[model samples]
Target chain A: MEDVKVFGLWSSPFTQRVIWALKLKGVSYEYYGEDLANKSNMLLKYNPIYKKVPVFVHNGKPLAESMVIVEYIEETWSQMPLLSQDAYERSNVRFWSKFIEDKSMQMMEFFVYDGERQERAIKETLETLRVIENQSGLNEKMFIGGNTIGLADIALGWVAHTLPVMEEIVGVKFITTDAFPNLHSWVKNFLEIPAVKNNLPPHELLVEYYREKRKVFLAMAFHHHHRH
Target chain B: MEDVKVFGLWSSPFTQRVIWALKLKGVSYEYYGEDLANKSNMLLKYNPIYKKVPVFVHNGKPLAESMVIVEYIEETWSQMPLLSQDAYERSNVRFWSKFIEDKSMQMMEFFVYDGERQERAIKETLETLRVIENQSGLNEKMFIGGNTIGLADIALGWVAHTLPVMEEIVGVKFITTDAFPNLHSWVKNFLEIPAVKNNLPPHELLVEYYREKRKVFLAMAFHHHHRH
Candidate 1:
């Protein structure tokens, strides 16, 4: 068997996505933690376009982008499928995944900045959650694509683990028992999965990491605002 | 056979992507041209979130987002396969497609505005082209995937057909034989396909449509800049 190598930053939720998918599929891989600020040549060569983390190297070839790698993992392993068998169902799953991937940043802007910008981001975040809640029937389905944790569930996985850390830091919570109840429960079902539960970065560690990162982010944001 | 319907604006290159894919795969579909300003209720219902086209309705169920719909078409039809058979190859195809889909709007910003903002957009757009030109293997391959026109090629289909019209309006050409010889040749290979060649809006019609659109966009840009 060829050695599978994953180049990622431990704290990146994006990197965590590939890890969860691989673990859920019961594949073995060696993880290499990269300092994103000082990227290794291997990481640079593997992912020159984005130079981002979660570059999956399998049997020498590398694939960049977390979700793209997740899809490759899904197709290659072909066990415990993340997407549905039916094409329409797969399209539906891909739609929600794409929605989450597209909106992930905008939905978390409140955690990154303060003031009116954060207020607008809060509204946008709620709308995103609302759309998902309406789409997912939490009463019937445990995960996004009925009973099992599928790709969309993985796509929204960070919302379960990271969103809370961000919410705690900012003192603003987007998901609650009253609003986004379906999505709220979906997060619970998502975390209970052994693969996900076991693979997550320690809660306190992520909080600490994001806390310091937030200060740097705020400084950068302030500088960017003033310059513009 | 159930009638396949596409709701889109004719001038929109996004709509043309679905059109090209269907035609390439030898699938029959009814085209419904919608006035984007006063969108049809069916269009709104089909694509509630984006409220944009090309919305693909196979029977009653609708799929929004041009590339998403293109993927759906490729999966369902499965004749003229738009992606490679190997998992890694498919991932590569999808990576580039996602890249194009994400950057499409930003790449076209220069065409929509003028002056300093447009200058910034122009720099961004060139960077995007440079990335693709380098990564795409355009020297060896006729299209993004291979010799055949696949999903990435379809994703970038607008660049061949629509970008020229935009260049004509702005008096700035992005892809040239001297600068992007590979992408330059790719545009030629892409347009040579009969499905793409015949499906594009007439040259004069597209130029006229975008000319009018550029005015509206500039006017809107002016208002937005002043309002801020």
Candidate 2:
């Protein structure tokens, strides 16, 4: 039996990325939910540097970083490949994955502010989605990389679920078919995957959780603004 | 015959990563030096999204982002492997590589600013170095993740070369032996590698180039400040 364990947070998109990857690969592992307010000692011990969730341990060795863990899962289990066999295709997937992950935090800016700042964030978010719609080859494929779900798809999975919750809280919509036809179709296809569809956290609970979290984030941002 | 070509800037650390990785693998390719002010049409066609070098082309397929290109080089050619074969060790290398690369841009802030902002950047740079010195296992090995040169080392290779040039211009030094003994030693070991040693841009020329570039960056920052 493989001794695999994952320390994660329930509502974290980063944690969901790991869970969805493992489910896609059909790897069974113990899951330990972490409280960000009071992180577990084991979680701290496993990932002292980041002290964050989705710390994966396999056969006694521990790994941090969600994408790093996902890539390791792909490397260790050859059951369902998250990347491509062709080196060129794999690099293409990786390039898009990096691009998406790098922008993930910034994408949340739309939900974190109001007024002109929020409008700027929304415009930037739309611009990013526009790039994905046109440039990521989504026009040709069902998913980010190809017809089959892959690493880039998992990297971008947050857009299908968490992004909607954020949009709901902010009373704004981003991925309409008129504006982002390819991404509109891509989101629907991504959510249709059994691994991704079945494994997501409850939508209502996510909305409630983020609603409260957004209050705190906005308050913090306001405080920061006043200080500056 | 391999059709390999690198579109790069001679003074760019990002471009140097691709060059070093190729040299480490003993791969030969034609090099095209890009003029940032007058970027080539081929370069723009190759990487339309970022439109930046080093854009690597192998057998006519083009790739952008320096680290992404370096990874492709590692994946394609098996000679003088830049990443560990073991998945666990490879994950470790990748984690540190991501950490360092994520901070690389911020690390240059000290060079771009003066007075308080520069001091803050310097302090943050030291904190980052301190984390690597104590936590990244440089105390146990000659390079990051192992005793041999690998991806993380290449990711961090900028610090060994370009950082010194920036420091010379700004009159601020980081990674002194007294402050970062492990990194100081690692720098020596990294540069001692014939691939890294021989392929570096001429130091005096790099110094001259960046000296002029810094003046422009400072002027731009000052202009932006006055506008605000």
Candidate 3:
């Protein structure tokens, strides 16, 4: 019996990335949902560095960082390959994975900020998306790595599900059929995958959660501005 | 004949990481020093997403992002193993590598800022180093992965060379013998490695370069402040 466990927050896109990867590989594991306000001691112990989820514990050895954990899963399980066989292709996938991971934090700024900052962040996010739409070759291919879903696809999988909730709350739709045809199609194809479609958090719940979260974030930003 | 070409700026630590890895593995390659102002068309073509240095091209296929390129080097050459044999250990090393890579840009802020911002960045950099010193288990182990130098070491190899130059320019030292004993010792061990020792950018040249670079960065920050 493989004693695999995942510690995660219910609404976090990072956590969802791990869960989707695990499901795609057909791995059965226990899920421990963590309360961000009062985090579990086990989660703390598992991931001391970030003290955030999702942390993957395999036979008591804990691994943090969702992408790193996903890579570990891919390496350990041979059932479903998450990376490409060709070295150059693998590097390409990894490059985009890193790109999206780095940008995701920056991209969230537009969702939580108001006024000029929000406008700047929105412009930057659109520019980043435009680059992806043009260069990722998602037009001809269903996924970042050819047709089959792979690491880069999984890394980017959240934009398909969570970005809609954020867009609804912010009153800005990023991936329209006209504006980002390739990205729009890619999102549709990504959501159609059984593993991804089945495992996503409820849309209504995500909208509610992000709505409150954005309030707190904007409040804090306002507070900081006043203090400064 | 294998065509392995690296397009890099001599002063970049990220580029040096790839250089050390390839040299350690005894791979012969051509080096193209890029003028950042007038970047080579090939460099621009290869890494269109980032349009940055340290682009490794092997047999016409380009790989960008230093860590991604290092992994590619490890996979392609299969010479001196940069990663561990165990799956779990590899993840741990990769976790630290990712952590350091993510924090590095923020860390550089200390060198380029003044007054309160510089102090804040310095404190954060120290806190990050403290975590590595206390928890990363460098005290007992020679490197991040047991005895042999691996990917994590290569990812962090910049501190041994570039960091000291930055420290000299900034008029502050981060890793002291008494403060970060293990890291200090590890720096000595890392420098003694022939592959690393041979490839390091000349110390005097680096110090001179960073001094001018710091002036430019500080001037840009002042310009932004004035504009605001």
Candidate 4:
């Protein structure tokens, strides 16, 4: 009895990464949609450190962190390999994956604040995007690491679906053909994958969710600025 | 016919991690000490994104990031496994490794700054340590993951050696017998390892180097504060 489970929030890109990986690997597991405002006891029990969503459990053992869970899923199930068979190629994929994962939170700065800070954040985000465009092997291959969608693609999965929502909310465009042509194409290619295409949360719902969340973030930022 | 080379700095904890992993696996390689002030063209070509140290080259293909290189070493050579053969245990080790790696820079904030910032940073560092001491499986096992030294140990290896130097320079102590007994013991166990003990940079030189670096950091901080 293969008892696998994922505790996640639907609109979260982190959560979606795990869901998409599971789907890609054809692993059927129970899904528990977590309410972040009021987290479940199971989540708290599973991940005492972070207590964040995308906690993957197999049999009785639990795992946290989206990319970690995705890697676990890939390793546990042999079908639909996300990383390459070659050690060097696998390391290359991991290098890009770590790069994007480390920057994932910082890349959302544009949507979280406004005015001069937003402009600065936008520049930083673009700088990171530019690095991805130029250095991440996107020109030679369709995906970030290689021709096929792999770990780097999954690590960067949020940009395809959630980044557009953030872009719309912030009213600033990134990943355009003129600015980041390679990323623009890679984004299209990533979304076209059946596992990714089918597993995404509804676009309108995501936009609405993030729009409200952005308002909260801006309000907190305003309060923080005033307090300082 | 094996070709393995490491481009690294002697004192950098990140670079030391790769070196220690190699030593632990008994994989001998040529080491090139990089001067951060004037990084080599090879380092630039190998890791253009960060232009950083600890670039591991195996058969001419270069890999960047300390933990990433460590993982590559673990995969390439299976002699003394840094991770568990069991999937769940490996994920657990990864979780703690990721946690420590993410907080590694932030934990150094106490050493980087002074006054109120240092206090706050110290508190943050203590909080992180508390989490590790209480939550991580250190109570049951001799190391972070299990009885043997593994990836998490290598990931948190800096804390064992370098943190003491930072503490000595800054005149503050963490991981004491009273504060973090588990980590205190873990530190003792980590240092006892042949790979770790033999591969460490000389202590007095490290202290002198960091003392100089800290002065520069403080000066930069003073200038930035005045400018703002």
Candidate 5:
């Protein structure tokens, strides 16, 4: 087998996605912890398009973008399949993955804004969550990709861990048992997976990191508003 | 062989993506043109989550999202392979496809905005184009997925056909011969493919439709500004 390497930031949910996928597949890879403030030359070279971490380099060839990398990993390593056997099932997984990827940033926007902007983000976030809660068939299945911990579940893994940290720091709760029971149960089931449980970053460290990041984000938002 | 059906809106680039992919693979399916004003029950039933068009149903299992459908088609019908054989190559294709999918709407913001917002959109559009032009490796390869028309090419197919129509309607051109030579060549090469050439919507009709759509978009923007 060729050598495998992962360039990742410690606190990134995207990085954790890749990490969990690798662990689930039982693929041994050399992990490089990147300081996001000063990205490594390898990270830049590997992912020149985004200049972001969570790049998986296998046998010298590099693959970037977390979901894409996860898919590639699934395809390359057949053991412990991340997607379904049926093409349509796989498409359903991909659909939810794309949906979450598009909305996840917007979901996070509430943490970095105040007043009307924050309210707008919160509403949008709830709207997105409602769609997932109602339409994602979470009540029927333990995971988004069926009974197994599959691709869509991995894509949504951030909500289980990272979102809670964000909620703690922001002092706002979006996912409550009464409001989104299906999604709440999903969070529990997803985190219970041994692969996900072992691979997550420590909670307190992530909260501290995001707390500082949120301060910077709010400051920038204020600066933009003042200028306007 | 199971029954195949496609629920799509004629004018949507996303619908065309699935159409082109199916055509390229020589998959026979019934195309149901959707009325956006009053969408069909099948469209709603098949794509309940988004209630969007370009829902492909095969053997009674429905799938939503254009790129996801394209991947399903590729996986189901192995002939006329839409992704590369190598895992790394496949990841590269997916990376570009995801990048284009994410940025295409942001790039379109220039079409409906005026004044400072329009200026910001134009700047963003140029920046996105520059990134694609410089780093997408289109100069050496015929398509972003490599020598063959693959998922990324189909994902970006709209830019070749729809973007020109949008530019004409908006009275602005972003991709010129000198500005994006590789991409320009790519457009020509992409259009020359029989599957794509034969499947595209009529150029004049697209321009007319987009012009009307832009009017509606601008009206909404005006309303938003006034309300805010």
Candidate 6:
């Protein structure tokens, strides 16, 4: 048996990215749900730098960062290819994957924030979605890269799960069929994947978790905005 | 002959990354100096997404984003391998490379800004350097991954070149022999690479360019900071 263990938070979209990739590759691993408030010493030891959850340990070697771990999984297990065989094609997909990874944090900020800052975050989020709609080849393909599910789709997997929860909490809808036709269709295709579909956290649990988080975040933001 | 062309600003560290990679591969190309104030139609056409410099064109195909372009160059011309051959090793180097890429913009911010923001940026830059000095394999090896100058080194090449210039303008010096002994040594190792040595922009010119840019940046930051 492979000695694979993962320290993660069930509700974290970042952790879910790793879960989906591992499942897609049919790689078996033991999962540990961590309390973010009191993260385990092992989690701190495994990732001294970030000290966050989703630490993927394979045969005792630890790796942190979700996309990095996902790429590592792709390399370690060739059973299901997350990227392309051709270099040009691979670079193209990597570009989109990196793009999504870079944008994900800012894109999700609105849900946690409120007032003018949330409005700014919403505007930036729409701009990011608009760029993808106008620039990415989603009109021609099912996924971000091509007809098949790939790394970019995996990188974007969080949007399907987290974005909606955020939208509900903030009372704003971003991905309408009219504004983002391709993304609407792409989200449907992404969620249809068994690996992605099966591994997501229960919606009610996630709403509860983020609802509490949003309160803390807004309290912090309120103090920050009013600072003299 | 391979039809390779590069759209770049002579002062851009990102553009220099592409140049160093090309030189290492012994590839020939035409270099176009872009007036960033007024970008050419060709540059805009080649890279419509960001419309930034370091737009690399090879055999009529255009690739943007410096690291993305560098990876493409690595794939296209296998003469000078920027990455390790083994999958695990490649992932390791790429992990560091991505880490650096994510932090690059913030690291460069202090040089362009003034007041408390610059102090914060300086602190962060030192923290970043401290992490690399302690975490990266500099005590055992000359470069980031190993003795050989690889992709991570190339991605970090700007720090070796542009950082000093920024320091000169900002009246602060980082990467001293005492403060960062390993990085101090690594800087010597990186600069010794013939490709890197041969391709840097004239220092006086970069100082002049960045001095002008710093003035503009501080002015914008001043206005941004005072906004109601």
Go through the candidates in order and give each one's DockQ: 0.82, 0.90, 0.91, 0.90, 0.84, 0.66
What lDDT score goes with residue B25 in model 1?
Answer: 92
* Model 6: residues with Cα > 4 Å off, grouped in runs: none
Give the share of true interchain contacts found in each model.
0.69, 0.88, 0.94, 0.91, 1.00, 0.53
TM-score, candidate 1, first chain: 0.97
Q: What does candidate 5's lDDT look like per residue over B48-151, in tens digits?
A: 88899889999999998889899999999999999988877888889899999999889889988988999999999999988888888898999886888999
* Top-scoring candidate (DockQ): 3
Q: In terms of docking quality, how is candidate 3 classified?
A: high
CA RMSD per model (angstroms): 1.1, 0.9, 0.9, 1.0, 1.6, 1.3
Question: Higher-DockQ candidate among 2 and 3?
Answer: 3
State the lDDT of candidate 3 residue by residue for A53-117, as single tens digits. Answer: 99999999999998999999999997779888888898889999998999988887888899999
Q: Which scores better on DockQ, 1 or 5?
A: 5
lDDT score, residue A135, model 1?
A: 62
lDDT of 4 by residue, B86-140 (tens): 8888988998899999999999999889988889999999999999999898999
Residue A35 in model 6: shift from native, Å?
1.5
Lowest summed-lDDT stretch of 10 residues in model 3 chain A? A78-87
User: Quality of candidate 5's docking, in CAPRI categories?
Assistant: high
lDDT per residue as tens, model 5, A1-228: 769999998899999999999999999999999998899999989888788989999999898889998999999999999888877778888889899988889999999998999999999999999989988879899888699898988888999999999999988898999999999999999989999998888999998999999999999999999997
Candidates' lDDT values, in order? 0.91, 0.93, 0.91, 0.92, 0.91, 0.90
| Comparison by TM-score, 4 against 6, better one | 4
Candidate 2 per-residue C-alpha lDDT over B100-176 given as tens digits, one digit per residue, 9 for 90 to 100: 99999998999888878889999999888898899899999999999989999999999999999999999888888
Q: At residue A105, what lDDT does model 1 achieve?
A: 87
lDDT of 3 at A42: 99
Model 5 chain A, TM-score vs. native: 0.98
Q: How far is B126's C-alpha from truth in model 5 (Å)?
A: 2.1
Q: Tell me the spans in candidate 3 whose CA falls farther than 4 Å from its real position.
A: none
